[model samples]
Target: MAPAGSAACVFCRIVAGEAPAYRVHEDGAVVAFLDQRPLFPGHTLVVPRTHLETLTDLPEESVGPYFTAVRRLTGAVERAMEADGSLVAGNNRVSQSVPHLHTHVVPRRRKDGLRGFFWPRGHYADETEARRIAARIRAQL
Candidate 1:
């Protein structure tokens, strides 16, 4: 499990109340919030309270409830957005953007034009610049 001081992570900000989010569901164990940069209208993210870099790192017991929340969120997204299909995916490889674990529950339509999660990457000049961005966002959390 990652400690609260893991400053270089986005999910930590949401968990810490330092950042704002369109929170749809929350509990002692997990939080489901709308994705800021969404693939679809009702795209949401299900994240555990405890930070785990990858699915393999989280305790086996947590998988059930985590996915349970995902299913529930998907149902809500479907009704609210009237989506035809849905896609919930997690990454263990390069597809994973933030290292801290998060599952994206994307509400899909018939012609969303989204083939997969592909976004271009831009690098910062140095660690100082990255820290500045992280700190600024953390303060807003």
Candidate 2:
């Protein structure tokens, strides 16, 4: 059965074989497939078999094995695409379009004309605010 709260999730449906995906690789814990809206031709998404909305939600025990699959897929993507390098990234809740935890492995080539980030960087309003944010994160840690 699909995990709780996973019925509406597209990735979960794909995992359940209720939807179609151009799957590239899959193991007990994770699956890798081509991105529907790809950054490049060979862009792929690696997702956990279980439905977890974000990295923070993933069980600590699952992290190493999950990333092992990611690492393997990264190497495979680079080799298969003949890319000079690859960009591997995961969005938390902020910019994540899908609720499921997944990593983007995009093949990159030199002079491909892709800029640094899709969004613009912003400066902290002031040093006080910056330190406050840092302190909050430090406290959580």
Candidate 3:
């Protein structure tokens, strides 16, 4: 695990509010926010507050709480986006854009065009749009 104060880690900076993020849910244990590059309109990333590099590095006692938050966020995301279902996934190391342990909760719909592992990212039209989506997700929580 990297130090919580690791200045080089972007996710750490986001958690510290040093970097900008549209955070939807935050608690003592975790933070859930809109993904800047979203797989879908309501894509979100749920991250632990601590700077654990990967899911394997997260403490055993933290696993349940960590996933519990992920589960709750998944439902909120799907409902907020009016999607049929969601994809809750985490990368231990491979394909992980940020080193910090975070889960991707992506809202899914039939014929939504997501295929296999090829993720086509999208962006919010503006900050206002991001904030609106974030607010909707927050409301569902």
Best by lDDT: 2
Cα error, residue 24 of model 2, in Å, equals: 0.8
Candidate 1 local lDDT, 91-111, one digit each (tens): 874678777788888888877
* Per-model C-alpha RMSD: 12.4, 2.5, 15.1
1-141 per-residue lDDT for model 3 (tens digits): 568958988888998999999999998889899999998998999998899888878899998889899989998999999999988888988899888989999999989898756667888999999999999999998
1 or 3, which is superior by lDDT?
3
Candidate 1 lDDT score at position 50: 85
**Worst ten in a row by lDDT for model 2:** 1-10
lDDT of each: 0.84, 0.92, 0.90
* TM-scores of all predicted structures: 0.76, 0.87, 0.80
**Stretches of candidate 1 above 4 Å error?**
116-141
Error of 3 at 103 (Å): 0.3
Ranking by TM-score: 2, 3, 1
Number of clashes recorded per candidate: 4, 0, 0
lDDT of 3: 0.90
135: Cα error in model 2, Å: 4.2
Candidate 1 global CA lDDT score: 0.84
Per-residue accuracy of model 2 over 1-141 as CA lDDT, tens digit each: 246437689999888778899999999999889999999989999999899989999899999999999999999999999999999999998999988999999999998988878889999999999999999999998
